[model samples]
Target: MKDYPQSVRRKDRQETDTSFLHEILDNAVSCSIAIEKEGYPLIHVAFYHFDAANNDIIFHFSKHGHAGDEITDGKKASISIYKYGRLYTAAKAVDFGCEYQSVIIYGTIRIIEGEQERMQAMSDFFDRYFAHIPDSSYEAFTAAQSKPIHVAKLRIEQWFGKEHALPAIATDAFFPAFPSVMQPREA
Candidate 1:
């Protein structure tokens, strides 16, 4: 890992364990990439595969989309993956809190060039999301190989992880019930 500056304000919540950080990266449902387009910032969320061996992330987007036009080789970007849990209610509004785990990575994007490398990255992506299914059971991967997509890798240079877990069950402030949904309002 590169020696990047640490600027986390809350040292108590700062997570420095490598294994825990990697776990978040591997299991998070989606990641958000922040990039600059035409001097303006843009964020794109997508499913990604965390390449632990290479210390990078692999993802793809439509070749015809705005992301395809904005992202380029050697472009610097920031990627963030996060998961949130139940809300903690408190009598004081300022005391309200929510459980969360997050990992932020700073890196440069590399548009994959070689056909073999691109194919391998896509295969790895498919496997990450569909590990429970047998490889022979689905033809979607095979079919998607011919699609017009740009498979790119985010080479991580620096990363930081932080988490705030819910208080113990003994704490009455933590809401243990399932979250209720809001009903649509009629005009």
Candidate 2:
């Protein structure tokens, strides 16, 4: 798919599964993680890297509040991945359709330890988020900064995904846009 055309030009209720997640991860960089500490709601906006084999999305953050300490075991962590890529025309805000791909995964996160695993986790994040990090920078990442901080990883348990686009009418019209669902397929 060159763009979200399949989702926009037509609507047929595109199905999704683990395969779809890999695509979303490639296009996404940041995810919102909502956690609660001491009965208070906490939301962390952090960068993450997705792993296909283990179906896990990993994160490393500086020692903040009790890192992953308060949540119940197997609790759901809501993580949303979103995108809006030139789906709207500049002149018209109501061109009501947006080219968007999003996935909300409710997963269980585990606090990771072990020096070797920690090092690998951080390295994996660098390769995914900053593929352009030079060799020297990578060395620095592994050598010095890998320690002192903490890493928490979320294992993807279930995900809900949707792909969206504007209908042809809205695509041609200049303004006064409204979102329209695709008509059902004929029997």
Q: By TM-score, who's the top model here?
A: 1
In model 1, state the lDDT of residue 28: 88
Candidate 2 local Cα displacement, residue 3, angstroms: 33
In candidate 1, which residue pairs clash?
none
When superposed on Cα atoms, how far off is each prediction in RMSD? Answer: 4.0, 11.6
**How many residue pairs clash in model 1?**
0
Instruction: Show model 2 residue runs off by greater than 4 Å.
Output: 1-14, 37-40, 65-75, 87-95, 137-139, 142-144, 171-187
Best model per lDDT: 1
Clashing pairs in 2: 8-165, 94-177
lDDT of 1 by residue, 1-187 (tens): 2454575788878888989889999788789999877777878888999999999898888888789888889888889899887788666666678888999888999999888888888888877787799768866655355468888899988888989886554234445565445856557
For each candidate in the order shown, give its overall lDDT on alpha carbons: 0.82, 0.67
